[model samples]
Target: MTVADTPQAAAFRRQVLIPLKLRLFLMQKLPMAWLAGLRLRQLTPEQAVVTIRFKFLTQNPFRSIYFACLAMAAEFASGIQAMMHVQAGGPVSMLVVKLEGDFTKKAVGLIAFTCPDGPLIAQAVAESCATGEGRTVVCTSTGVDEAGDVVAIFRLTWSFRAKC
Candidate 1:
């Protein structure tokens, strides 16, 4: 069976990762996410979503959300998926080797970023475990504004290596 199908991993995600307070605790430790008021809106084996509110701290001089804050939220959306896979499968070291962001428009109000490639990531981690080698996956995070307009698209290349 695949690691993602394991019961223990599934339990951990539902009982631990799904709770807002737990997610908040994690975000609090991350200074940028905390400053941006990032929230974990949803997390599953198939997708992860994060939101950052447009506030004074996150706003730029142009009266829009800072690009960095948007990038932070987008990274979280993709990173959280990798975290889930690592948590479920086994010990693995993961990092964002590269990041590419496209700001299509001004980010205002509440901005939500979604990554819908969790399953693919899980498979890659499983392969890495089996081969005892590192794997890289390019995950896409799409950011949308409160009005449902596309604000930005972030592509993050995450590398995962199994622990020795």
Candidate 2:
């Protein structure tokens, strides 16, 4: 069966779809994201969307969202898909080995980060699990403002390794 068809993956999607459940999950596991008001707008096997707003807790001195907060949202856009694949497959460890970001515009209001590399991540996870080796994939997440202007681009390299 495909990774997305797995029961665990379905459960994860369900959990992310429910606002209260997602908030509780974030509160329990990712307190920082919860505090920063990161929200999962969409999630699928092929893509994921996350959003963050510019507020007191997530803004910078320059009156824009902090770069670190933007990175967190970008990472979550890709990381949630990776987590689903990992849970669908056998035991595997995932980590962010590298992160690169390019800011193109001032981020204000609400910013949405979308990552469309879920298939790549799933393949990497499957390869790692099958070969008992580690595999890495670079997932690009793009953040845009409400006007659909590109605000930032983040390339995150995720490594997946099978457990012994």
Candidate 3:
């Protein structure tokens, strides 16, 4: 069997080649973007997990993760989770009025922030929708490094209002 015609080669071509090609296209070749090719997979209304590969440009000296990147990840996780709760026809936008962060350790690998479903988001959305006014919700997110160590903790308070 020739290399091009081998079954294993064909499988690799399908699985590895196509995804890599798509990644390069979307990540490098695109101009109009919001996500910057960040994957939102393993996410849901109750939870948000972001995977960021440590890149030099986005990292601090000593190969440590950047604080700004940690902040971004926190916002992404909390905001997306909150937004998804409003997908059932309830809100305009979440205005982050106040937020605080506590950096505990140096992050050197991918991090995940998870906030599950509960009264907090519901209360915030409900209050905003009920009055057609705004309410505040404080959401906390913790980022863990590759070793499952707490790298950072963030708290965001948002003023929410219904678009309807």
Could you say which candidate leads in TM-score?
Answer: 2
Q: Which stretches of candidate 1 lie over 4 Å from their true place?
A: 1-4, 15-20
TM-score ranking from best to worst?
2, 1, 3
How displaced is residue 36 in candidate 2, in Å?
Answer: 0.5
Scored by lDDT, the top model is 2
Clash count for each candidate, listed in order shown:
0, 0, 0
Find the 10 residues in a row with the least total lDDT in model 3: 1-10
Give each model's whole-structure lDDT.
0.84, 0.94, 0.63
Error of 2 at 7 (Å): 2.4
User: Could you tell me the C-alpha RMSD of candidate 1 in Å?
Assistant: 2.3
Residue range 42-160, candidate 3, lDDT tens digits: 44434557555567655788787677767776776776556555554454567889989998888776777654532476567767888898878888878887899988888888778
Candidate 2, superposed: residue stretches over 4 Å from native: 1-4
